[model samples]
Target: MNMSSNMLSGPKDTTRTILVIDDDSNFLNPLKMSLEEEGYNVITAENPKSGWESMEKHEPDILLVDWELPEMKGTQFIKLLRENKDHNARYVIMVTGHSTTDYIVQGLDAGADDYLIKPFAIQELMARIRVGIRIRELEKKIKEEIKKLTVLEMALSVADKIGNPISAAKLHLQLLMEQETVKKSPELVESLTSLFSMLEEALELISKYQKIKEPHSVPAPGGKTMIAPE
Candidate 1:
């Protein structure tokens, strides 16, 4: 796909909040406007201090950072952000004139998730930003699903361990052995006494989990509420 098309064609219900950190208003202004036009929420910071503050406040979905700044370079900024555990989820794309592999590696090591060289095409930048955002979204979804699976697996394991019918059988067997020692009739005392207690206890434990039977869910009134065609 072409650059702009690829950048703009993600699922529409979700969009990233982008932070553009560059002192060059000429670059920052246009990029911000374009990103906003494409349905992203764009926030801009003109200096390093302001950028850090914006990062803290907005906790942006993605960061577009200039490689060189008057006070602090982009690599250093990214390093600081990475070291802070709270900002670990922030995705960064370095904006720089340097296009070397070494520079790219430095950016990545400093926790830049992506990179875009300065004077780069707006379409290309947007495409990279789209990629960063999509990766983060997918990662989040995967983590959530894993959490749910872990919980379900734990529940099933507990059920398996505690729900065995052998527990009830063991209790009955112990009671029957005691009755036998006393020379009691197996049919009259052993069977009746042991089975009754086991069944009663099992039923009580089972009742704790079974859903309370509610009245049947009735459909809404008004003849099922038909809708007219548009």
Candidate 2:
């Protein structure tokens, strides 16, 4: 069943986005309606060239494309997308009338993740999309966890490198505090004690930072989502 194009009014999705690249309105329009009805954020392009433009604009999590296009075939488009340096870990699925084993091999070898033949069942298509969404979410979560781990590793390294020196300095200050010569000068002893207290605070702060394994959310340079420290 086709759905109304008017998007549902609600809080914006913090979920997956899909970009569909196909020149055929008969195919593209209905596919757009079906996916959107299923609550996906769908963006469409008429051809492969404009599809690249949309890719640059959205960096969608999932890409749905038709095989036969005007300027470039689906194979060429997938190859180009894989080569992009700033590319997302997008799931690319080719929807084509070509159903031969040879065509499927060609698409997959060129970096298309999955393929669907024309007149495909909408239910099956949704199933494939759900699989792609699951993979995307898992990868994103793993990446975030890795970033947090890396930050903690760095913090630990910094603490290890600086810790010995602070410990040694504190010991020397304590020795000075105990000396009769040093204890005779009240002002000098007080200064030494203050410095000793600061070193203790530094060690405490490092202990607290080391204990934090949870990821810290910070605004990405310009991206919409938050990024954990690396």
Candidate 3:
């Protein structure tokens, strides 16, 4: 059955779908029941084909996949899902007997968001689920903020990139006028023009300072040239 897009709204819901893909019925059943008892809708598949079919039919929010399956390797299954555009939204966690760091790295490289070693604590598994949900929410909020900032930055950048100096000057002047209107600072306009002139003088002074060198020699008594002190 196609799970409603609105069904997995959040933690408040009565049931959240989780698809467990493990060839071992003993492990899969217990894990599914544990999550179901915690108010999640659980589905189990023994192979990648069934798992993919379940994912397409139910649109599960989370997929718990075993590292070893009879039909295909766990990493390969995950890679296939990741390469499919439609499956990109599903959050997959790998369950594996391979507990070494090398295996974990391989799972991540294959695009698993997280992994659980075989014989995981039920409580810890649930906690991981909560963390994943919270992270997804935070990620969504950050992406939205980034998008807004990108739009604003692009606008400012385009204004700065405009080639016409007159257009640039007009933009700056208009910005100053807007600021003055907001603050009611009529004198700011004159102050800014004066400040610009002062800034030009300051820049010239800096250039002159850079060009300055110690006098070649100091005049000594009897018109003798004395070398400058080192």
Candidate 4:
């Protein structure tokens, strides 16, 4: 068994990394050079074991795996990666000489994001890579939006629970401030006045928060943006 590994750097502006796992040196060498020429960081591993090690170390954005590997089939390797949460999100493209429907279905079922038959055009492969990148980016954005919505829902729940208490506290403070004993002592009057004002502000803010029908973005410090009630 011939095992080999190589890492080739592409253009500095390109940040996408692609890992190619194939035992055929003749096929792997040119493919690595082609991918690098197309402005992608390329890592080549001749066997599945080395490929898995490289995946753990580099966490490449895309995987180009040959179907027949030395230690395990490409589908099995893809399945293994899918089972591990850390690598599951990475896009996988299975390369195989077989074009049978069964093989294609098997690879897809094993968690390959795409399948490329052997002897494919580099242009087609590059196009597939572009589509994969776009889909991955869209998925990431969707996940971020979902997380933001979840946080917003939790915030609304907390605001609901605390709203009545804040209003009650403000009302009680108002009643206490109206008492003769508090009004007689200047120091007590001043302290109670400040406390009442704070409670009033809290109630007002909670009222605004609970009435939020939509979220709007507001500029924050350091050129950042924060979500606010619209």
* TM-scores for the candidates: 0.67, 0.81, 0.57, 0.87
In model 2, which residue pairs have backbone atoms overlapping below 3 Å?
none
Clashing pairs in 3: none
Q: For each predicted model, how many residue pairs clash, with residues at least 3 apart or on different chains?
A: 1, 0, 0, 0
Off by over 4 Å in 4: 1-13, 213-227
Better of 1 and 3 by lDDT: 1
**Tens-digit lDDT string for candidate 2 (57-166):** 98888899888998989889998888886773679999899989999999989898899888777777777887787788899899878876786678778888898898
Question: Which runs in model 3 stand beyond 4 Å of their true positions?
Answer: 1-15, 143-230
Q: Per-model C-alpha lDDT, please?
A: 0.72, 0.81, 0.71, 0.83
Q: 1-230 in candidate 3: lDDT tens per residue?
A: 12122333235434568889999987776676667766778889999999899999998877888888987899999999999998875688898889999999999899999998866666667767777666767876777666645644554444344434544554575566567373476577677666556545544443443343432345789987543322
lDDT per residue, candidate 1, 123-176, as tens digits?
A: 777678878878989989787666655644554455456666656665666666
Q: Of the pair 2 and 4, which is ahead by TM-score?
A: 4
- Per lDDT, the best of the predicted structures is 4
Alpha-carbon deviation at 138 in model 3, angstroms:
2.4
Off by over 4 Å in 1: 1-14, 164-166, 169-230
Native-to-model Cα distance after best TM-score fit, residue 225 in candidate 2, in Å: 13
The candidates, ranked best first by lDDT, are: 4, 2, 1, 3
Candidate 1 lDDT (Cα, 0 to 1): 0.72
